[model samples]
Target: MAKTQYYTATSIDGYIADANNSLDWLFEVDEGTANPFGEFFAGVGAFAMGATTYEWVLENDNLLEEPQNWHDMYGEVPCWVFTHRDLPPVPDANVFMISGDVRRVHEAMLVAAQGKNVWLAGGGDLVAQFAQQGLLDEIILGIAPAVLGEGTPLLRHKLHVDELILTGVREVGQFAYLTYAVGDVARMGRHLAAETATLLPVNF
Candidate 1:
């Protein structure tokens, strides 16, 4: 089975990008620490992102024209971009454009994933949508030291997360990378119920 994961940085206030949909605040960190993120990306089999994130990369020409060292690390993994409007394809065949209902896009992603990890390269709203639908398996957050007064939050609206176990924490200079394994709600509920039963007072 393929695992769906969300990997993003957030402000101390839990915002992913600024009000203008800019991630300038996150860039303030010393770029040296970004190697770990590249390593994390290398482990993934494929990539998936919302239309806005795809456009942002294209407009700015941020993504490298050719596969970088990180891309080599991951081999020729596929990347699917979910968009509402039509857009030209990337130079590399590895990158594909997808437009349709989000669920259908997800199904296509899973097929493209093919037992490998699927990265949900988010721009906030899209991530929130998948998170709300309970499609997310893990959330890998690179918590920056800086704070943003206002921006797009990583999570919006109410979500019932049964539990999030901290798998690992790494301190990269001033920033910290946190890995969390978000468990299934039903399994967590059962464990919580058992614990509650043990803690409750027994009247015989």
Candidate 2:
């Protein structure tokens, strides 16, 4: 089964980017000799991201000056950018600009994925929408050794132990990689409801 995964690197304090929305801290760390990025990309048939993340790639990678970089990174894989404002598309790059419910776009993404996994490459807000709607299946977080007092959060919603099961943990260089399988929201909601029923409220 193709899973919807959120693969991202974050600070020790759970921020994916700094206050300036920069990933300088992430770039400063050693990613190791392992081809995790390549391997993961191979399994990703499609990807989606928000406007900020899309623009970051456009500026940070200088995609305009070096259009080949976009091809080198994503190749022919289709990228969906969810944004309200108009954004320029990279020449020769397979990208679609869209807005509205993520659920509809998610369905389209799955079709494009062609049995491979769908990667949610995003700013936290976008990922939050997916997870909140019970669309996200897995989370692979590469936790860096450094901390950013405050910045963009890794997750904007509450995920209890029952909702997220730890599946794997590995330490690579200075980063601690954690993999978690998100539970079915319907099942988790029912379980939580049962637990709530068992609790007695005290009259204050």
Candidate 3:
């Protein structure tokens, strides 16, 4: 079955980007020869990203000038970018710019993905939006051996311990990779309600 997954790298302190919204620190990490992103991307037939992430890629990779780079990386796979402002698209790349209602966009992504998984390439806020709607299925985090005092978090929303099951763990060079299976939101809500009831005062 195709699942919605968030795969991204973060600092040791759980920051995806620095206070300046820069990922230069991540690029400095030595991935060695065990990087798993290739394998992960192969299973992703379609992907989505926030405006910030898309802009970063555009700037760093020079997608506007050298559009072939985008093609070389993703081939014909479709990509949906969530943005409120007008942003230039990469020539010849399968990119869709849209905004509002992640649920609706998620449905489109599922269809575009065919039988493969959908990747949520994101800024923390964007991923949180999907999580809040119970649209996220899994989280794969690559923790780099660095820390940023303040910056963009891995996820802006709260994920209770009971809502995540650790499925895998591995070390790749200076990075620690962790995979988690997201639990059903309805079950988690019920658990929270029960816990809250128990904590309430019982007055005669």
Candidate 4:
């Protein structure tokens, strides 16, 4: 059973990227040596991201000029870029440009992931689309000690109290790592009413 998880780093104000859609601010913060990214990435057989995120990585890393660099980050792990336009592929990187029903892509991602987990690399809206389809299972965020008044949002869906369960939290230097298990929103209200719990903070 491969679970679909949205793993991302965000500003304290819930922005994944700055107004320019750049991560320069995020680079300023030190997330500490002991981070959970490595452990989580080890189980991700496949990842999917929106065009903006994919393009940003491709440009920032110079994947086209230094093609091999792409492998160093993601190896042979398959990557799906949800886009409507054609995009150039980086030499040997296992990347694909696709657009259509997210459910269909999710099924493909699961198959490609084998028994491993499916990672939802983000641009916010794309991940929300998955959440709405009930294809998203978990959310992991590393909250940096910074804020971008307006930028790329962390998530675009209206998930209420019962929609998430706080599974874990870790304070790593200036960053706060949080993990939440996503539940069925339709049945979430009922569950929360029974438990008498408040909704988790949507800071990031």
Candidate 5:
């Protein structure tokens, strides 16, 4: 089964991005310290993000030109960008733009994932939509020390009760990274053996 996961950084107040949808706050990380997110980043097989995040990465950094070692690993992995407006494609072979129903985009992502993990690369609105539909399988958040008074929240809506289980936590400098696994929804179904056991009278 394909598991969908989100890897994002949040402010102390739980904002993932600023009002302008910028991640300027995230760039303040201590360069000397080891990154706690390396493990999670290594595990992702594919990345999915909204158009805005994709555009920001390309324009802000010469990311498209100067390829880093991270690209050596992530470059081969498919990057699906959700966009309504058409834009020039990334020069790399791994990046692709998708415009369609969110559900369809997700389905295509799963197919492309091919048993590998699918990463939700930020954009709370997109993440919320997947969570609402019970399609999101995991959430991994890196909480930065700074707080933004107002910005884009980590999640926009309430999910089903007991829907998440914390798997691990790591501290890197002033930031704390947390990982959660989505509870299984299919477990709610009753099996034939369980039904038969329920029907049988209790032994006196």
Candidate 6:
């Protein structure tokens, strides 16, 4: 079955980017001979990203001056960028700028993905919305050896330990890769509701 996955790198301190919103620290890490991202991305027929992530890639990769970079990385896979503002598109790339509910976009992504999995290329907050909606199924994190005192978080939402099942763990150079299978949304909702009920004050 096709699963919705959030695959991204993070610092040891659980930040994706530094205070400056820069990923320069990530590139400084020693990547082993084998990069597993290509393999993971192969199964992704469609992907979505928040405006910040999209803009970062666009500017950092110089996708405007060199649109081929986008092709080389993602190929012809459709990308939906969640942004309310007007952002320039990469030439010759299947990029869509959209806003509003993630549920509708998720449906479109599923249809576009066909039998393939959907990837959530995120900026934390965006992925949290998907998780809240029960659209996110898996989380793959490449934990790098770095600590940013304050920066963009890995995920904006609070996920209980019981909600995640560790499926795989591997070490690649200085990075530790961890794969987690998220619990179903329905069950998660029930758990959250139960917790909320416990927190409610009882009448004297």
Please, what is the whole-model Cα lDDT of each candidate in the order they appear?
0.72, 0.90, 0.92, 0.89, 0.75, 0.93
Better of 2 and 5 by lDDT: 2
Which ranges of candidate 4 are over 4 A from the true structure?
185-204
Q: Which residue runs does candidate 5 get wrong by more than 4 Å?
A: 64-73, 183-204
| TM-score for each model | 0.77, 0.89, 0.90, 0.89, 0.80, 0.90
User: Which model is ahead, 5 or 6, in terms of lDDT?
Assistant: 6
| Residue lDDT tens for model 5, 1-204 | 567888888988989888888888788865337855566666667778887777777777656575463375465778888888886665655888876666777787787777778899868887877777778888888888878898888888676556766777987777788888774632232243478889999988
Clashing pairs counted in every model:
0, 0, 0, 0, 0, 0
Instruction: Give me candidate 3's TM-score against the actual structure.
Output: 0.90
Compared with the true structure, what per-residue lDDT tens digits does model 2 show for residues 1-204?
899999999998999999999988788898777767787899999999999999999999999889899999999999999999999899989999999999999999999999999999988899998998889998999889888999999978788878886778988877888998896843565577789988968678
Better of 4 and 5 by TM-score: 4
Could you give me the TM-score of model 6 versus the true structure?
Answer: 0.90
Q: Better model by TM-score, 5 or 6?
A: 6
| Global CA lDDT computed for model 4 | 0.89
State the lDDT at 179 in candidate 2. 91
lDDT of 3 by residue, 25-72 (tens): 998999989749888999999999999999999999999999999998
Off by over 4 Å in 1: 31-34, 62-75, 161-163, 183-204
Q: Which tens-of-lDDT digit does each residue in 144-184 have in candidate 6?
A: 99988999999998888777877789999999999988868
Task: Indicate the TM-score of model 2.
Answer: 0.89
User: Candidate 3: lDDT of 18?
Assistant: 98
**Could you tell me how far off, in angstroms, the CA of residue 67 lies in candidate 3 after the best superposition?**
0.6
Model 3: lDDT of residue 175: 88
Candidate 5 C-alpha error for residue 38, in Å? 3.4
Pairs that collide, model 2: none
Model 4 earns a TM-score of 0.89
